[model samples]
Target chain A: MVAKLKDQMTPAERASALARGEKVDRLPCNPNIANGAARIYGCKISEFNTNAKALAEAQIAVYRRFGSDSIRIFTDLFTCAEAMGAKAILPEDNTADLLEPAISDLSQIDRLRPVDPYKDGRLPVQVEAMKYLVDAIGTEAGCSVGVVGPFTNSFFLVQMEKALQLICKDPEAMHKLCRISLESCKAWAAVVMDMGLTPTISEPMSSCTVVSPRVFREFSLPYLKELVDFIKSRGRGVTMHVCGQTNKIWTDLADLGIAGMSIDNVASIRQCKESIGDQVKVLGNVDPGSVMYAGTPMDVRLATLECIRDGYDSPKGFVVMSGCSLPVETPVENIDMMMDTVREAGYPIDIEWVEAEIARCKQVLGK
Target chain B: MRTKEELLAELARCVVEMEDDSVADVAREYAEAGHDPKEGILNGLIIGMNQAADLYDQEEYYIPELLICSAAMYNGLDVLKPLLPQEKQENEQKIVIGVVQGDTHDIGKNLVKIMLEAAGFTMIDLGRDVPVERFVDAVRAENPQVVALSTLMSTSMQNMGRVVQLLEEAGLRQQVKIIIGGGPVSTAFARKIGADGYSVNATDAVHLVRELLGA
Candidate 1:
């Protein structure tokens, strides 16, 4: 049936239709969830962050309850960083943060070789959780796992401030730390793939729009290139989530052998489709905060439809997702709206809904 | 025999000095020169810091550069504070800033605080991960016109709502405008929690302060 639908559509039509973009049966809803789903299962964020089983169960339960298309398994950016030696601080009042350094000093890099994910800090726990998830629902249900990018891991290793300074003062030390971070991530990526899960890495700092594109290249790029290669060599799809305004390095990132790039609202999705849309999958640009948090479920549905509409034809890929992690306070119904939009709209859709959103834009343009 | 170049140089010098104590000099030099305090702020310090903010956005500048420049701007504002006419000085708004509980992400919050201070608001920084009670107590104690909350983690968003609710429960909501922004914070979330404003970056946060204060 999917092939038949693709036969009737344009290349963009085929891609969006497969993904259930607007004009298709309905849009695919695959928003990134951290520990937020834990609330749905009556689990604490602390439990959700530390215990892989609880985390997996809560994600599964939430996806099942909400009728979501995929269950994203990301327990904050500190998971892989922890395995590299950063201590995970799962606080009750906030997202899990790293408590210990992955490397206290550059000397520790030689001492801090990457361990097998199965034997490392919490990797086995995560793999076991994925295995449990696979056992319960299987791959037809769509399960995704997260790997922290080297730069973010390095951020935890020496703290964000110290890391940012080093980008300017000690580029070589930053590069070495990036390597360790990559080793840890590659280890997790290997394990997640073995468990039959799609691997996605979140590059929180690759956007010079956040840090510097130069720093991103000097401190982040080479190692990330290696991790991407590792994932591909394993025959798994590699999704890159570059948070913040990353238009500055969009082409650079797209050229890095990534299968998908998750973007925030800062960059125009259409522009992204035009630039790297053909090279890899493009998944996102939705202001998850606005539509998912402040707007009504219908608003989320409509805004998602708009994203799908704008993303109608891409090079090789498109996935409906929020520009960043879904806010913890995001109403579950809003998430459901995204899936519903995809399911309802099907594929090859556009901006009539955008007309309402564009009122602010119009006022800005004085049209 | 003051050269035009010398005067401009002095202007730059005083602008840096404005942040020295209370930014009184920032206000004073302009007031003495028969210039608008708002114009003085725009052309002199805010403009410079804004450039710094741009450099930050472009990766052309880093935190140390941002922090020290903001510090210099804040000091210039200090030197200008007492020198400004009483009306313009009094017109300067008061802003209350804090990092919500359970978040030790101080760099972004501190940057916003510095930006706000540079924008000439009397800032009461409650520091990082402040409890709800403290936010309430600080508000009651300082009676700031606006309350700005920062939280970098998705987990602390609930705390932000609690702080907003606490202010509302205390019947202080009407008197204080609430603004929130940080990594992991969305404008939608801010509106969902009944905050008056949200901005994506520190520059926007400073601009939002202007809008919230009706300046």
Candidate 2:
């Protein structure tokens, strides 16, 4: 068989053009990188979670090996919470968990001090690491730092039960804690955006699965818009990510002041592209757990192709990425297959080939 | 100051509104009024908790919301437990629930526990990071009709299949149904691991349990 053509532009150019709503040479591919990078560095997730130098090194290593459009500096979701007095429990191979809340009660919302990224919590480790990532690849790649959203960070600070209780019992206190968490988010973002990298806000708890659209409208959207505006004002770009069941909140999230948005696997990418593709940049969402971790490299290829077809058929501003965190045990060969499919089958996707492939998928999927 | 029915409605309302602080007070009032604590609990608190669970299934309520509502439910239960009559059943449908070994993320498991309890299932919650042997031991001890397993990590999902294998070897597979859930779990995964049922969210786990147990 004769070779098919690939998109001509570089990944960085494709990413930049797509973010600006300009024509892209092809879809930019950035598999969701986080603790997944630890596997590449041959270190425990605890090392990546605790040590700044290792994190920066591992992040860069994955960027080089995987050939993603963006180099992300997201280690875990609890750094800001750790900064604000919530303790983090770092496991040997898994991501960190909240050991204890800084303030057990809502009464302490007022007493909560601001997180200084350099001085407070684990945010400084990330800041120093991201500086290294940007220094290494400032011009060659897209650099973005990750942080949890306001609602989630607040959950870490007050614990989960109180976080939900205050929402109904005292909206004022919940909003207050969310705002404080946003400040921590902004403080962390301020340090990294200063290095000219975009900030990818992974706000999983703000999704419709965790909150009603009514609650999301009340709490997450305003704070996110403010986060976007603040980042843009600093002369940097912004990317938003919410992990699961984001379909309910996509229209509103797409309308935010962001350069790109990452939707998880549960949401329909085709609908997202059709509804808001003209408005903003969309990234993501293959099932990071099953397809990337459990399935074979061929599975990754098929998923990548399906995602590309879904995105390409809709509009121009879509970047193929994982739906959520790529598991720490995700196969390197699977990553390669995903990138290969993007390069081989994505650009100028053959209509007959995709149709044939879809039929085969339905047959293989036993539908 | 209020009648029993009004206090019951108020108890349910506090849970629907996520008023963890006030549900306990309403329970106390209902008890102080010479109202049947069983009636107050059944009519007031569980009703509200069931409403919250429904809302959770509908995605209108989340982990946090359900967490507080359950707290309120327990508060009311604490006031009513001593007065309630001993319950009787011919064959009690028991359930053993826990996060499978190597998984520390228990919020999903906790939600499942609350929802199952609200649905009136007797649950032996082994809690998070429970070893595989502990599950077999729990089954042997409790003789549960079902074992509901949970995990948020794909890495720990391997343990679910192992538990099923251990059960088969121990000859308990014929006696008990096994169910699985968590963020990374799907219907396909549950099938792969020999789990009898799978639910994506906490609320549906109750429905799954009810269906599996013929409840």
Candidate 3:
């Protein structure tokens, strides 16, 4: 089902209109395509992530080829840790990793210096990429600078187990570490916002799968609310994402005052629509790991149709997106399948065509 | 003068409460008063960890609780290991575990290690971001009966498969079982990658290894 769009606005315009509660041509297709771009350009991910010029070129290559509704500048989850004085292992063809956290104990958390996004490891590379995108494609192109949310960044600075233990064992220290993370996020987001880039805060480990709602409310919620308020206070937009089963905290997330949300596949977009009632923009929830990276093109089409159908009738707006970051080796054919479906989906969905495609895809991607 | 059962129960309570510091105090008391340290662990410390594991199975305790309980359990282990018979220590079944290459998420792997050690399996933890070839080397060196592989990233999912193939090429596949688990791993992926078994939670990993060994 190839869609020849008659009314194709720039991705920036469509996203802006959708978030503003106005009519849109179709849902914006802006999955967080990070290292996947590195693969497309045939460059080592380690090199692509570190070099500003290479990062810009890879993003530009993806933008030109895919015509995805939005362009996201993502370095890695560990950039926040690396920026805060932790040593990171950046591999040749993989995402950067920091084995030892910045804080070995709670006492050290206070000593962590605030990161300057300009001079920090590869953060400037990210900001420059965002600048390059805005320059090359004009401001009409959708763009967001990705930042790690405070809750997950806490784990980045301290080991996940030790950090989580602090939640129940020593919540006072946990709260303080979260405050430190919040300060770091504000510092980083301010830099990107000053560059005219929207900051998208992603908390991959903040899902129900990792922390129960009680823990989330105590540790993650207030900090997130603060982050959103800070971004909004500056009169700019912010997007928030959590990587796995987040249905438990969906309402809290909707009320966090972000322009939009990106959810993982385990979260049903239909439920998300009901919970929020179109008060905020909803993006995402195709299983990036299983359906997009592992499954065939037909699986991608099926998953894309499922997300659209569930969220198409929402009150706020929805963008068709992968639930999370595309793996380093995500297949382009599957990506094209998602793009094609979004282009053809026609605003106020073409149910008849969609029904036909769903039926056809069912046959192709049968259980 | 507390009964033997009552003293052990007190020791068990220390672990269940996640009091790492006071657990050693209770162990020393149990030892000074003539209670067997090995039994202090088996019927005392291990029992407490077993209760924690049960709570974990019921979703009452999570990673944090388990880690604290493991800390308490290790506190008791440190006091009791010196008392265990040398023959008992030398003859225990061993298991090799690691987070596969390219994957650094080891909280799950660490949990499994804690549970397995509490269950009395000697573990050789290869640590996170482990090379694929090391699985074969560990299997060769440790002669362990099970090689457990874990990865949290989807990109590193293929490395689990590579470890399996490496075991096959090294002719060590049949000598020991391969078990895999993590966020992105599934039973289907395990089968596709030729792993012998897959368990989503760390608690179930002990059972999987037991079933593989017919224990």
> Comparing to the true complex, what docking class would candidate 2 get?
medium
User: Which residue window of length 10 is worst by lDDT in model 3 chain B?
Assistant: B83-92
Where does the lowest 10-residue lDDT sum fall in candidate 1 chain A? A1-10
> Which of the two, 1 or 2, has more TM-score?
2
Clashing pairs in 2: A285-A323
Model 3, B1-215: lDDT tens digits are: 77789879987888877887799988877888887878999999999999888988876776777888889998988888798676746567889999998877788899888888888898999999899989889999999988999888887788899999999999989998899888777776787789899987888999999998889
Where does model 1 exceed 4 Å of error? A1-27, A48-52, A92-94, A103-111, A139-142, A348-367, B1-51, B57-93, B184-194, B211-215
* Per-residue lDDT over A279-314 for candidate 2, one digit per residue giving the tens place of the 0 to 100 score: 777787888876887777656767777787787665
After TM-score superposition, the amount by which residue A59's alpha carbon in candidate 2 deviates from its true location, in angstroms, is 2.0
DockQ for all models, in order?
A: 0.27, 0.51, 0.47
Clashes of 2: 1
Q: Give the worst 10-residue stretch by lDDT in candidate 2 chain A.
A: A1-10
- What digit string (tens of lDDT, one per residue) describes model 2 on residues B1-215? 78777898998998777777777787778887888887887788889998988787776777667777888788778777777777786566789999998778788888888888877778899999899999999999999999999998776878899999999999998899999998777786787778898988888888888888777
Better of 1 and 3 by lDDT: 3
Task: State the lDDT of candidate 1 residue by residue for B1-215, as single tens digits.
Answer: 44433433444554333233434443454566655544555566676676677766666775545665666666655555455566635565788888898787888898888777766678998898788789889889988899999976655778899998999899988999999988767766787799998987777787898887768
Task: Rank the candidate models, highest TM-score first.
Answer: 2, 3, 1
